[model samples]
Target: MRIKRPVKVFLLGMVAIVLLWVIHSYHFQNQQFQTDRASTYSELPVAATKVVKHAFGEVTIPVKPQRIIVLNDISLLDPVLSLGIKPIGTVSYLPQYDFLFRGVTNAEAAGIEIVGIGNQPILEKVLLLKPDVILMREYQRSLYQQLSAIAPTVVIDLPSLNYSFKENLRFIAQVLGETEKAEQVIAQYYERVKQLQQLMGERLKKIEVSVINVFTDGIIATYSDNETYNQVLQDIGIPLIPALAKQKETSLFLNIEVLNKYDADILFVMSESKNAALSFSQNPLLSTLKAAKNHRVYTVQQDRWWTYGFLGVNKLLDDLFKYLT
Candidate 1:
């Protein structure tokens, strides 16, 4: 009995030592884990950001966004591409009419995926892209919230002005912190315009140019000051028909019976359908117009003719020189 008591006491002492050792090791390990975690996180640098105010609301965005996605082609993508930043993705309604966009770089060839048709975007593709920023026009009011959830989205509600491209380009530049580049681009564009003015000389002031649209449904109409061709014509000191210059609406519907109302010294038709263009050209009444008699009535593609903004205007200049010179 005396030996048993002594052995029990010795065993209890050993057990207590073991418990103490275990507790010490666990505490040391937990502390080492915390220290390592903090050290690892501290090694990475924080990303810088800036706040920008847009049509929808203010949004905080990374200063130099690595990935950008454009939702609207004509209004949004035009300016984004004009600023020289190739987007990660964009939406185009007419992929077949990509010649208008070739000035900026072929969207697919430049690695810009078509997220969806027209202004609509594929949310799943957007999520996979992990874009740092998204640019769009206010035409996508329904999609603003949904896109913002994925990234910092800036919506541009452009005013309906004849010279809206300047404002559009400047606003996009401000959003991207590219004001200097914008100014440079603007200067370059105007320099080209100046060259055109010098090349065309006084003939620009004499000839009355007009843009008409022949819809696929056989509707014939002429564009007013808001059209890209009109904008470029005005910039180069070209005279537009009185009906087009004074008109407020974007398009003026004209009855084919009174084709004289659509007459101009030089006429450019934006034909959406081959059949409609053929019918318009074959109409006996068209021969009565001075443009047709002089062989100055040209049929143009809607996508190429309607594209607006910096690169778009430059493309128009290329066409103008082809026809006029």
Candidate 2:
């Protein structure tokens, strides 16, 4: 067991170096472990158990979403709020559409920040929130890659551009994990429709209904038979005029001459804006129509028609039915 002094000293140095290396490695490993935990906690803001697929592809719906960023579609806010979840941030639209925004007070009370996400939403602003989930519409797929990089994104498909209320509500319900809620809402809506159907069933069955949207310049636009307005009317047992049904199923703009061409028992006019309303109401050309002469013409605001929200649709339908009756 006897060793030279030089060998003893050299061995001691070797042992010291190994001990130092071990300590450094331990600290480094501990720091890295903490960093990893922080990364998980920070980036993923919710306790999620499942991922759901929607019309906009797939998203991981958190067990409870805490920081939801509604990018551009404020219309979807009502359903989320109805499910008892409040969004942290939402985009700002015109005041006329405030009926669709449900979580404004909760967001304000939470000190939630609202950045200018733009009409299309901004990627940098979205990334800053570190959102748990983002909701948009199917038409905004162009931002998919950029949004996905920041957080889970879900896009709900509307009933259609031509407008289908049933499909819009169904898809939105699927995205919110509220297929049952959606069903319930739809069921209630159908019940109302059935009542209206009974009331106007025989009358509408005999007479055709027509909806025309008029702009400031006397341009007349009519809804396709597939549009949500038409769907609602049809569900209530009303039928569209043959000419409108035969026309292409899209948002169509025609001249004032369309009034002479399509003879409808009831005509609903949609004003594109305030100015359009002023012009359409006073147009000498429109005075010749039976609807205009009998003062059966009704003007609907464009914002309510453009937004596809559950509550919004119900309100619009209620108003329409009340007027019709």
Candidate 3:
């Protein structure tokens, strides 16, 4: 059968439109690339530089680096942002929990270019950003030569020493000459923790809470006492389910049959994607959980909760106060 002339004409128009869009996008990106190449390279103005020993080696960095690039997670980005310094570029956060931290944070918000999707960096884009200092975890040492060629790259550990914000922030702040600010941030964070304790009072000791992560790969695990938001929860004085608290490993994976053993007065479920968690919850055994039956199970996006940052931790506290209180 011969196609109708009007429908065929419309289809052809749509195809032409799509083709033009693709061409336009290609040219736009190409032009931007060229523009980036033409831009002036950023350099610190002969400022006082201090030598900080890191994973790679000693790196002499600017006393105050203006165009900062964080190649790792908020472990570094948090200190920078919390200390009132904005980085020029950074890797994207998992699941984008911007909604939960809208007004309270600018962690990965406007004015910050996502130079990488996850842990992978787009070197060209990073080079174009013209960072004065490039910060990354020890795992990213392979890119040290390439990235350092663009700027003074500092290789630091993500947790540094077991996910303590004090040590991590103090070190990064010292690197940036913002140690004073780091102290203030640290004090304030703990102050909030103290406030949480006082706010909840005796009620905190009685409750048994558990935070579990449902991965897209079908791996279900609970937070160890000091992993992820567990530390924060521990600080808030919420007694995690006895079984979860006793585990020495970072991630405690519970079998389906043992769901009853990991019972909690409050269960917080977070995941990489909504579906991963939804699928996990489909198991009939979950219905056996006290929290499940009592309707104390709260599901949330594993964005800031999974991130190691002051702002993220603060947001996690907000969730606890919202849910528990």
Residue 189 CA displacement from its true place in model 3, Å: 1.4
Task: Compute the lDDT for candidate 2.
Answer: 0.67
TM-score (all chains, Cα) for each model: 0.82, 0.73, 0.78
TM-score ranking, best first:
1, 3, 2
Q: Write the per-residue lDDT of candidate 1 for residues 102-219, one digit (tens) a residue.
A: 2254542267887987578999999899999999877788988899999999888776333477777888888888999989888988898898888888888789987888754446
- Candidate 3 whole-model C-alpha lDDT, 0 to 1: 0.77
Q: Scored by CA lDDT, what does every candidate get?
A: 0.79, 0.67, 0.77
In terms of lDDT, the best-performing candidate is 1
> Cα RMSD (Å) per model?
4.5, 7.8, 19.5
Which run of 10 residues does model 1 get worst, by summed lDDT? 100-109
Off by over 4 Å in 2: 1-46, 55-57, 78-85, 92-118, 159-163
lDDT for 78 in candidate 1 is 72
Clash tally, candidates in order: 0, 2, 0
Best by TM-score: 1
Residue range 1-325, candidate 3, lDDT tens digits: 9999999999999999999999999999999988776673443334678788887788878778888998766577766787788888877654453332221245345688878765678999999998889998888878889998998998878555666756777778888888899898888888988877887889887889877777654567876676757777877777777788788887677655666776789888886666778777887877889999999988876665766677677777788778877
